[model samples]
Each structure stands twice: as C-alpha cells, then as structure tokens.
Target: MAETKKYVRIKKASVDGVWYADKIGNVYEVDRENCVSILTKRGIRGLSSVLREDAELIVTEKRPAKVGERVLITVAAPIGKQAYETGDVFVAESLYDPFAKDIRVLGIPDFIDYNEYEVIVDNELKNGEADGMESTYVRKQSEGLDRVAKSLGYVELAKSSLKQNGFIGEVHTFDLLTECAERLREQAQTHKEKIERGYPEFSPVHKSAQARRDEIVEQAKADVERLRENNIRLRTFNISLEVNRKDRSVEAIAKRPKSNRAFYGIAKAAPSDCFNVHIGKAIALRRALGLGVPDEYLNAPQPAEVRVGDVVYGKYSEAYYQLWCEDEIGDVSYEVKIKEIVDGKYRYVGGGYDFIDDADLTIIDDSREGVVGE
Candidate 1:
C-alpha cells in the first residue's frame, strides 16, 4: 500500500487592511487607501516594506513569536478598546463604505518580506510622508472605537518619542527597538545564571569536554583492535652455498619443506596467487592458532580430535580449511591445508574432510542435523 502525506490547514489574513486580533478573536478592516493593491500597484517595494514592519511589530515588540509559529493579524483596533464595552468578540464583517472595495485576503509564509517592510517605511519617512496615516479613521462600534483610539494614541506617542530622539519616524523602527530591548534583557538574564553557576565562559567546547574525551578513548581502542586483527606473518629462508678452494668445486644445499614451514604467520603479508587470503582469512587463522584469541573463542569448546586431513571452519569469517591427512599422500588431507578467508566473502574447501555447509554455520553453540557429532 502507498503512504499518504499529511497536511495542515493555516488561517489567512487580508492584505488590504490593518490586521488586528484580540482575546475574543480576529477582525479585518478594509481601507481602500491602505489596501495591499494600492501599495503594490504604486510600488510593490512599498507594500513589501509595510509587511516587514508589521512582522517586526509582532515579533520584537507587541508579541514575540516562536520560529514558524502562526501570527494572526486583524484590521480592527487593538485590544482593550472602549468598543468592547459589552466585551463582545471582534469578528470580521463586510464594510459599508464604497472606498473599501477590492480588498483581498492573503496567506504568506512567516518572515517573508520582513526586511522589505522595514526598507519601505524607512524610505517613506525620509521623504516626509510618514504622517500619511495620521488622519485615517478606522470605523468601528463605540467600544471598538475606544480600543482603536487607545492603540492609536500609543502608536502616536511612540512615534513622537522616536522623532524627538532623532530616531527614524517609522513603525518598524519602533517595533525593532522594542524587540532589541526584550532580547537584550533575556540574554542578560541567561548570562547571569551561567555566571552564578561558576561558568565564567560558556561555549560549545566547554559543554562537550567530557563527551569529547570519551569519544577519543573509544576511537583509540577501535584503531588498536583493527591493527591487531590485520597483523600477519611473512616467511623467509636461508640458502647456503659451499665452495672448495683447493678443488675449485662448488656445491649448493637446499632445505626441505616442513609441515610448520607451510604455515607463514606474520603481522601482514600479501596473499599468494596459489591461495587467496583476505582479512577474514587472517582472522580465521588467528582463531585456529588460538594465539592471542579473544575471550569469546576461549569460552568455546575445543574439537574432540583434529585429524591431519580434517577441515577447520571459522564461523565469523565463513572461511574453510582442509589439512593434509598423511605424509605418504604428499598432499595428504592432513598435510596440505587450503585456507580461504577474506573480508565480505565466503569460501568452501572440502575433499573427504569433515566439513559443514555454509548455510548451517552459526555463532550459537549448537550442532545441526547430519553432523559427525552432536
């Protein structure tokens, strides 16, 4: 069956009017003069600037928003207005004014165009047009009117203060300043807590010091184990040449190959072309030799009897070996041992020697059916 994708429903606000929301609910107001289209048609840049300012207002000052959190905007006046006398919730309704036509509701991703709004407001104030909305009256019920008045008065006072202090007469500036102040306070509190806890300097390195030490130790152990497992042996022989000075005669002596000579155990060596040896092969050899064997191998039971021609199998590497059985048979099963061990590979070698099938090989200390012994 195919999987289905999930979707979430998000509320949209009109771009035509001032969006306002109270504890009761949200409301939209249509002011043709301040509609999104007018701002866009006159210059999309201007509209973008307004949106940026509004977003900063919501984030830095009015109500700080979490990242990706939904922000609701309404066209009605701010909360705590006189029009809310009956404590009636503000609801969006059609405007009776003809000038309010052609307003639209738009849904946009949060934080989009925030910087643009700042720029537009900044440019407008620089051109001495920041007071354009001073005479704009938003129609509402008595309580709503009172709330709007209060909100507007607050906005005016804020603007006047900025102007007197030589700050830009822009809504975004006021909102951003408020936001900066709040952020500064939060940071100050956080710093104080860290200092009280005896942490004069707070950094990622200090926080993860212990964890980093543990990680390094673990890595070192892994590297050592890897090196030990990869170790192999190399075989070297000494050739002797005899010379008789008086007779001017020379003789060369060659050494016979012994059973032990066949086994070249070294820390590292390339596999011979006659036999393929891989990392798995090296591991299996170590296990068969029982040299430096791990505890897991030490706990395992030893074979009842390992004949010359018997086949030795490694469970982990899936490698198989057949030993030459006798001396008369130059390549007797017990004498000639063929070992196959390689990383990421399995090998099979059997010639009348006791051997287990690949499929039956397992780590558990249990025997499978049809084996020579239980």
Candidate 2:
C-alpha cells in the first residue's frame, strides 16, 4: 500500500460546529464547513464529528511509548490483525513519550482483504499506525528489551480499522522505555536539520530548553570569536579608509581622529587594481593600532629607531603563504619585534625592535607626506 493513501472523503454537514478531537488528541470547535474540510483534508479514519459535550471526552495521553512494547491493535483483517480477527501485534515508534502516541502495526502478509483499510490519521501509517486512543486496547509495556517501534503506516491502517469497529474514542500510551538509541538518533537528526537551516529548536525530551538555548548561544559566541581572531578589521577607530568622491582622493585615517579628518595615510598614485585599496586600508589600520609601519606612510617621518609610535602593516608575504581559509589553515609564519605588543600580538601593537643609531638617524621633511593630493 502507498505510504500516503487517500480514502473516501466523508463529508457530514451535521459535523459543522462540532468539536472533534484531531489525531493528536486536541479538540477543536470547528464549524460544519470547516469540519468537513479538516476531516477531508486529513482524510484519516477514526475521525468523528464530536459535539460540545463530547469536548469533555477529550483526554490527554500522559504515558510515553517504549520500544518493543507489545500492542494488541483491535483492527480489522489485512492490517496485522487477521480478517475477522480482533487483535494484531505492532511496535511503538519512539523510545519515550513522543509528541504523538502513534503506534505501528503490521498487515496480513501475502494476502489481500476483500475490504480495504480506510485511510485515517491523515495517511499516518507504515502499515497499521493508530492514534493514542483508549478503550478495549491492551498495552504491555516494554520490560527493558531491545525492541523497535512499529512503523506508522501499518499502525494507521489498524487505527482506522479500530475506528470502524467502534473503538476510536480516547487513546492512551503505555510501555515507555528509559531511553533508546533510535529515539536519540531521531532527535539528533531533527536538531541537525534545524541547525543547518538556521532554525534550531532544542526541544528534545532528553535535554532541557535552557540547555539547548545555551548550547546555541555558546556556539554562536565561539563562531564570532573565531571570526574576530582570524580576521582583521579596519574600522574608523582602527583606521578609516575613506574615498573622497569630491576630489577622487582615498584618505587613510589612523586611530586618532582629527577635526579636519587628517589624511594620515594616502596614496597619491592611482592603484592599478582594487588590491591597493585594501593595502591602503590595512596601512591605516596598522598605523592606528600602532603596528610597525614606516614613518613615510604615517606622514610623521622619524628616525627608523626603536620607538613607541612606529607602525608596520604586517602580512604573510612568504612564498609558501597561503590565504587563510579558516582557523589559520594557510597562515604564513613571520617574526616581528614585540616591543609594542597590543592584544597579545606584535602585528597590531607597536612592539618591534628597530636598530637605528641616533648619530645619523635623520629624515627629510615632506610637507605633503601624509596628505596625498588627488
């Protein structure tokens, strides 16, 4: 039988404004028009056009299902229960009390029944899956046995049969296992899918909601840390790479902002490609962070001697240096003077050793050194 089988569409006008319990045991006060639409849309057997008084008949299932729990589904023949026979064997799908008390039962093997199993539970069946209805149903709880829950398709068929035989009022759950690996796998798969889709929901019975939320928050925090650690930023505080469209000038401002936005680092020559823009940004950021940058770029040319204000825009320019993919996958190794270390790195802080004897440590004055005229 198809996993999703459509059965006869039962439309009862009298069912309008009737309070009926869905397959999940939830009672809905649906009007006649909506009731027919819902039942037909669900197309599951055992569905009834309940009235307001029947609303009180709605009972919530509390006990959970266990693996290998013996179930005697009182459905018609061809769906695990032999035709004209009363009971059939099936398995529970989940380890503990899942969202639903659906069970899976088998069908009569290698035989066809004159009557067909009605599609109920909205095609929720592996063979004879049923809802958590009580009354005349026997449940032998699992006694710590490695048993798998029955498929829903088979159980649905049986559930429909039970409804047909007048035993579809209230469903109950019994035989809950402590914990099952299969159930864990299901939850894990759901969790994984949600994460991949960026809609993670940690509502597993095994874990607390706070625990799930904490894990997600921690994971996100770790990711942000990783990005910040491995990546470099050139913001205005660090350095501002502003392109003046008025004069087509690219100004690189170091950490200390000026009232006039002094161009601490500017490239007078037009860059061949976009790489120079990045280079300019890096230079400005490195200067702002007090890295060991040449005095020429800082517009404050001083002796190339070990000093506090010297900056150097550092990068992995080695032949074997590969662009960093992630987690320092292809980082080039280099040693810098740690005299002006900041944030535990010499690249961002000005902690480098520059050996320049003061005797001849002199620099030519350039009026337009830092201010690159467009």
Candidate 3:
C-alpha cells in the first residue's frame, strides 16, 4: 500500500496585514514582500520569529482562550500542503511552549481550562523583584489606585443621573403649578373688585325672572286687542264671484271652484303663462279635466302610427322648430322625453328611433341662411 498522508486544515495567514487564528494555538504572521514560491524554496522557519510579535492568535473553538480573550500575536496560517511546501510550521496544542521567553523556542502549559485562574508570565513582577522586598508593597499600592478609579467612576455616573432627572421633574412641576397659582390669584382679585363696586354677579336666573314678568304684561295687552279684531272681521261678509268660461258670465250663487282656493288674494291666473309642470302635477291636471288618458302622452308621437323613419319638429317658439328625425329605415320615433335643460338647451331622449334610414336631416341654421326674421 502507498504511504498514507496526514490531512490538515488550511487557512490564510493574513488579509491586508490583519492576522487571523487557525485551529491550533500557534500564530503566524505574513509579509507581503515574500511570494509563496520564494517562501516555499527558502523555507519560513527562520522568518517565523521576526513575524511572531506581530502575529495575532485567534482560537475558533473552545480551546485555551476564553470566549472574549484574545492572544497578543498576529496572523494564523493553515497546515498541510501549502504550508508544508512553503516551509510553514504546523502547530498543535501540546507543542506550544509559552513559558519559554525566547521567541525562537516557545512553550505553553500542558493543558488550559476555561474560567480557571492560571499564572501568566509577569514580566513586570520579575523586573520589580530586583528592588527588594519593598517592591511587593508598591504592587499592593498600585492595586488600591485601580479600585479608587472605579469607585469614582460610579459616583460620577450617579450624580449625572440625579441632575438629569431633577431638572426635568422641576421644569414640569413649576410650569403646571405656576399656571394654577396665577389662575387662583386672578379669581381672588376679580371677587374683591366685584365686592368693592357693590354690583351683584350677573346670573341667568335673575334675568330670566324679570323677562318672564315683562312677557306676561305684553301678553295681556295682546289678548285684549286680539278679541276686538275678532269681533270686527267676524261681522264682515266676503262676496266672491265665480265666472263660467264657456258662457262668459258670472253666477251670483256659485261657490268657489275646487281648483281655486285663494280667498283674500286677487283672482288672477299665473302672470307667466309658461310654467314647469312636473309629472305628478300634470297627472293631477288630467284628473281635474276628466281626461282618461294623460295629455302629455296623448300629445306625444305614436310609434306604431308613425313610419319607422319620420321627421317631427317641436314648436318650442314661434320662430324656431327643433328638428327630430330618424337616420335609418325600419326605425321608429319612440317617445321623446326631456331629460334636462342645460345652458338654455333642452336635451331629450327619443325612444325606439333609428338613424339608419335618414342620414341627413335639415338643421335650420338661421345665421347661414341670411333670414330677415330675428
């Protein structure tokens, strides 16, 4: 069998000088100056230390680093083919030696547990030890300063909350409370002025009582005059004359016609003979005339008696006749009802009328004909 190859995941070392972490804890940095082909031939182990400080280590899985903690190094590179060919080192969790100070050979703890306290390499603690046992006391003093800073921050935040809430509450209460005080002051002043002037406050009940007394006096006087007028007109007799239109004579004993109801008004027909007769009013006139058929319909053109295409005209005025005709044969001139009048032009609907028989109907154009009549 052929030699089995180990499979390793790969990742880019950097993007635009920014570093990323890979599966393993070891970090690597990329240099834009070196190409992949050059790095593969020359190898990357020697260059690893120079770039180590700039490399950022990112732990994707729950490995050594906590959820939000980050490593101080730069970019991470993948393992396997490209990395191997490029002479890039593959990192495993066990291989990191973090305790070693030299970047050339580093070591890490055997295993890291999350949320557990572990002692990191304290370079400052090591440097301070040279100053003797007094250096320990200085370290404790530095911790006290940190606590003071945190406490001051919380106090300042509380003061800001008090000022912001106090200002808003004061402004709202002052505006509404001041307005109520001014209204009360005005009412007190008005009451004092009314008392000094010796004038009673105007009230509707007092005015209504006085008005009722005056109304009763006027009503008594009107009742006395009304009785006197009733006695005078009651004795007066009214003589009305009924004229017989056929005989052109008046009847002495004739009572008023059922159609004529005006008593005191002059007996005269409507001044304007032209009147707008609605359908209901025309029906009433037909009943009074004892005409079994409606006069409006009787005057209307008969569709059966008239030919399919016949011309008829309306004598609206003595000088003009509005033309009505059919445009086609087998077309009847049905009932023409006036629907509306707009701008002195009467619009009517002709029922059962055909336009196919007569295409040309004479429309009287007086202006074009040069007629003498106005």
Best by TM-score: 1
Residue lDDT tens for model 2, 18-52:
33322323323222322102222223454434321
lDDT of candidates 1 onward, in order: 0.27, 0.32, 0.28
Model 3, 1-374: lDDT tens digits are 22111111222332233222333333222222110101011133443211111222222322343221222322223223322222122122121246322121012313222322211211111111123323433443344344334433543454456567775466554454344334334444544454454323341111122233233323333442443354346633223334332232222221234444332311121222111112222222323323342222112111211111222223322222223433333333232333333443434445332232332222111011121221
Model 1, span 66-92: residue lDDT tens: 321222332133233323221122211
Best first by TM-score, ranked: 1, 2, 3
Local lDDT at 367 for model 3? 12
The estimated TM-scores of all candidates read 0.17, 0.16, 0.15
Query: Which regions of candidate 1 are displaced past 4 Å?
Result: 1-161, 165-176, 200-225, 231-374
Q: Order the candidates by lDDT, highest first — what do you get?
A: 2, 3, 1
* Whole-model lDDT, model 2: 0.32
For model 3, where is the 10-residue window of minimal lDDT? 33-42
User: Lowest-scoring 10 consecutive residues by lDDT in candidate 2?
Assistant: 122-131
Off by over 4 Å in 3: 1-170, 200-218, 235-374
